[model samples]
Target: MLVLVFGYLFGGAMTVPGGGDYREFLLPGMFAMTMLFGLESTVLAVTADTARGVTDRFRSLPIASSAVLGGRAVADVIDSTLRLVVVLLCGLVVGWRWHDGLGAAAAAVALLLLLRFAFIWVGVYLGLLLKTPESAAMVQILVWPVGFLSNAFVAPETMPAPLALIAEWNPMSATAAAARERFGNPGWGEQSWAAQHAVAMAVGWPVLLSAVFIPLSLRRYRHLSR
Candidate 1:
């Protein structure tokens, strides 16, 4: 609710330091960022289970270790999809619309869900590695920096050179930028490769994250002793 309100109020009051339609540009970015919030659901679930010895009890069972993680993944996807519906309705209430055809809109939805899927593995891995629920909770602070460093609420070029470079290349930026393009919303009028190739990067970021985190998470899950 706070995020949706900030997107509407801030997007309404601020221009992109240029002539771009801030609210329209901001809506898709907010959509992508909102999907990322599912990280907490996965993290907290895993950490609480571990802290309560539920995971240890599951580990002692005869079932495959993969089933535990699979159950969490399935539940998270179902919950995230429901939450996405609410966020989409909120976006519509704020005057955000996709001008593109249904195919493009569907593609945007896939990318957003894929991004959430990839982040789930990341949170799972973190939860398995952390010593306590408190430590796992602290990991959430990393999400704020990760979300803000991207071109979600502002154009990367507007930042200082060092920060701008980081922002332009942030994986979240690709998904948000791709979302704006696919949704036919206003975008930064830049011609850089990152700006021009948002869709590919967005697709690649999730794939890369999943590739790296899946094995790590499963391995950590199997190593319950660690």
Candidate 2:
């Protein structure tokens, strides 16, 4: 909420390169950003559980280890969905509307949630690895760079060639660009392969991230018992 207000306050001067309303461009990116922000809370929750011995207690139970992580993932999904809803309503209040059909809008929402789902494992891994609130708080330092380095607030065209290339290829950029395309909003205005294939990248990035992190998380969890 605070972030959305802050965006609205300063988003006026942010001109889209191809000439479109900044709000339209800002909202879809905001949706993706909202999912990214959930990482902090997920980390905090897991670290808190570990710090308080709650995770150990869970491990002692007859439940499978996967169930323990799965439960956290489910809880985070609900939380992410609620956050998305609030932001969506807030976007509507600010006069941002999806110009695409309902089906496309639904796909956009699915992609946003999928992004969140993939990040859940990341948070779980970090939270378990960190195992303390102090360490988990460092995720905050990581979050801003990951969030802002993408094409969320402004287009990649507004950035230098090198920075623009990075922004264009950011996972968040894929999701943001895909969401914008799905919602029929303005995009980063790049003819590059990444920009043009946003949807595929959007799906692939999360899958790839999950593939890498899920194993790391499971391995980290196993080591926790050592």
Which candidate tops lDDT? 2
**lDDT (10s digit) by residue, model 1, range 92-188:** 8977788899899888888888888899888899888874777776876988888899898778888898988888888889999998888888888
**Candidate that scores best on TM-score:** 2
- Evaluate residue 137 in candidate 2 and report its C-alpha lDDT on the 0 to 100 scale: 77
Going through the candidates in order, what is the number of backbone clashes in each?
0, 0
User: What TM-score quantifies how close candidate 2 is to the native fold?
Assistant: 0.94
Alpha-carbon deviation at 224 in model 1, angstroms: 1.8
User: Would you estimate the TM-scores of all the predictions?
Assistant: 0.93, 0.94
Overall lDDT per candidate, in order of appearance: 0.84, 0.89
Error of 2 at 173 (Å): 0.6
